[model samples]
Target: MEESDIVKDIEKKTRLTSLKKYMWGPNILNLTLIIMVSQQQFLGRLSLLSTVLLLISIALNGITLIFFSKEIRYEENQQGIHKPFNKLTIRLLIFIIIFFGAITIGYFIR
Candidate 1:
């Protein structure tokens, strides 16, 4: 590919990466916080419905993360450097596991 072609493609991939990071990082955190506070303050902790909602949100985010990582890895294959993406995937996997575990614990504990 020409240099300009590669530049545009790189821009596309970087934009995808930024969107994925925002959705999973701060967006999920903010959503969970909102759900938790709404349940606590509005519902008076009277139900597990909010935890269920949080679990659904996390599951959807995990699926999106997986797909985004796959797309990014495809974009990076031309450069033959996969270590950084692998580390990111691993970290995301860990985050997914922890969130699922914590939500499960919160559901049962409460």
Candidate 2:
């Protein structure tokens, strides 16, 4: 089989351009928490470690998304699977919200 055929097969089977599928999980989780934080009731109910994971996930995902967005923007002027600036801005906003929320909860819990 040709190299291009192999790549096409992989892309078709995975339904994501390898990079995207890998990054999607964490980004989606971060977005989930971003939504969670907006709901007042879920704030203190989750365990501290869980909260920590959520915070870290948001941070890492935000950073990853930023890089991903920048790369996408540089690659093509037209839109592809994702919009670079929108994804970056949303992830960043989510990270900020989660950071402040986590700090506020930590103080109250302590």
Question: Whole-model Cα lDDT per candidate?
Answer: 0.61, 0.61
What are the per-residue Cα lDDT tens digits for candidate 2 across 1-110? Answer: 45696776565445435546566776677767755544435454666676667667667777777776666554433324445456657756766777687557554654
Error of 1 at 65 (Å): 1.1
Q: Give the clash count for each candidate.
A: 0, 0
Residue pairs with clashing backbones, model 2: none
